[model samples]
Target: MSVNNVRNIYCVGWNYRLHAQELGNTVPESPIIFTKPTHALVEMTGQEIPFPADQGSLHYEAELVLVIGKAYRPGIRVDELVDRMALGLDMTLRDKQNEVKKQGRPWLSCKGFLRSALITKTLPFPGIDNLGKTEFVLQKNNQEVQRGNASLMVFAPQTLVDYIGSRYGLDAGDLIFTGTPVGVGPVNHGDHLALYWGEKQLGECTVQLG
Candidate 1:
């Protein structure tokens, strides 16, 4: 399914222990939730992604994205919520994000910009029992930069769905970005970024700066 069909793009932060430590953050006991509006949706169509002209230090966060096919109430099970899976990029304006954080403010500006959410085409869901075997790898400029597995996630997909649902019931078209792994770094003009599930290339996009 197309990301355009999604209503809300939910995101979890610091969900990977090593990633949290890499950024000098303490691991949270519960999930740190945030969101991106639908307007931020961007398809990984092998085109150049125009960088936001006003910002610098655009960072790439490779994540596992879950596509919800069934409407889930507070008590819904994980198996009933996920319809498919895909690799996604949670693009961030890092400099702006830090500035806002220093001032103790909400920083949607760093995350919720046009074409900020880049995703691959959805593939059939790997059942919860097999999630531990799922893995993600990211390449920038043709070099491997990040790698992670679902087994390393502090809050597994099931727990994330349950926690998010108890507070806010999810609709059939909701999308969840399950957070990034370590080695997230900046991308510059003319750089290429690619995401993969094992050796299978899922999506790739170029960075365009003006």
Candidate 2:
């Protein structure tokens, strides 16, 4: 799938129970959907990444991403429409997000900055049955910082696709970020960030604060 041809970028929030609790938030009964523009996308190719330094507390959110291969149809299963899957980073400006949350404002400013969405190479999706047994991890400077699987998600892939598709609608070329787990932390300059799907290392890159 060509990332450049992506149409919409949908992201789920508070999908993991542990992630919600870690942030002192309650587990939401349903998925919380958000969006990012196409400009936020950046492919992870072992390059030096430059981040906006003025944004306070730049956070790295490692997530499983779904690549929608078919057009939307109500009541469709995620696995039916998603042709591939990948590991991704949904970068956030934590302090700015907190400030907006206090005011009950949209999170676009904090979540939709240029190059905020980072993705790895797309892999043909193993069946959902097989996927349930797999997990993804993120390491900061060679130290494991986050680990998560489908079992701990508050809203699973099925629920997310159904909700977002039925309510807002999804289409071909859309990407859904299935949310992150606990152990989310700020990214700093010179940090070596590595992402993995099970034992398979996806990619790695170094961070540089702009």
Candidate 3:
């Protein structure tokens, strides 16, 4: 299925130990949840992404995205409910995010802007068992800037689904962006971004300052 099949887009923050520490955030005792509206999605069609003007430090966060294929049921396992997976870029306006945090505001303006969520074509779910071997990354200008392995996630996909399902009610078409690892960094005009699953390049696009 394509991005059109996707419903709610849920995201986890501070879910990686090193990522949390790098951001100077306390390691959360529980998963920190947030979301992006469907409007934020932009398929990696090799189009140039126009960065929001004046939103300082646009950052690239590579994450493993799960496509929920079944209706939510309390006892269901991730492997049973999800049929596809993909690599995504959770683009953030870092400076704006930090400014809003100090004022106790929502991250919506900093995260849910147009074209903030970049996604690629989905692949068959790499079942929980093979999670250890499943790896993804984001390469900026031919250099690997960020990478993630499901096995290294602090809150595994199952746990995220379990936690989010209990409170938010995940639907069959919903998408859960598990979380990003420690190497997130800034994006800029003229920069080329690519997402990879192992040696396979899933998708790509160029950045153009808006």
- Judged by lDDT against the true structure, how good is candidate 2? 0.90
Please provide TM-scores, in order, for all candidate models, with all chains considered together.
0.96, 0.97, 0.97
Better of 1 and 2 by TM-score: 2
Poorest stretch of ten by lDDT in candidate 3:
46-55
lDDT of 1 by residue, 5-60 (tens): 78989999999999999888899999999999898988887889887857868899
TM-score of 3: 0.97
- Backbone atom clashes (below 3 Å) for every candidate: 0, 0, 0
Ten-residue region with minimum lDDT total, candidate 1: 71-80
lDDT preference between candidates 1 and 3, better one: 3
Query: RMSD per prediction, one decimal?
Result: 1.1, 1.0, 0.9
True-structure Cα RMSD, model 1: 1.1
lDDT for residue 164 in candidate 1, whole number 0-100? 86
Query: What is candidate 2's lDDT per residue for 1-210, written digit by digit as tens?
Result: 677899999999988888999898999977899999999998898999888999799999999999988877877776788999999999999999999999999999999998899999899988777887888999999999999897788887888888888888888899999999999999999999989999998878888998
Sort all candidates by lDDT, best to worst. 2, 3, 1
lDDT of 3 by residue, 140-190 (tens): 999998878888878888899999999999888899888889988887789
Model 1 clash pairs? none
* Residue 104 accuracy (lDDT) in model 3: 97
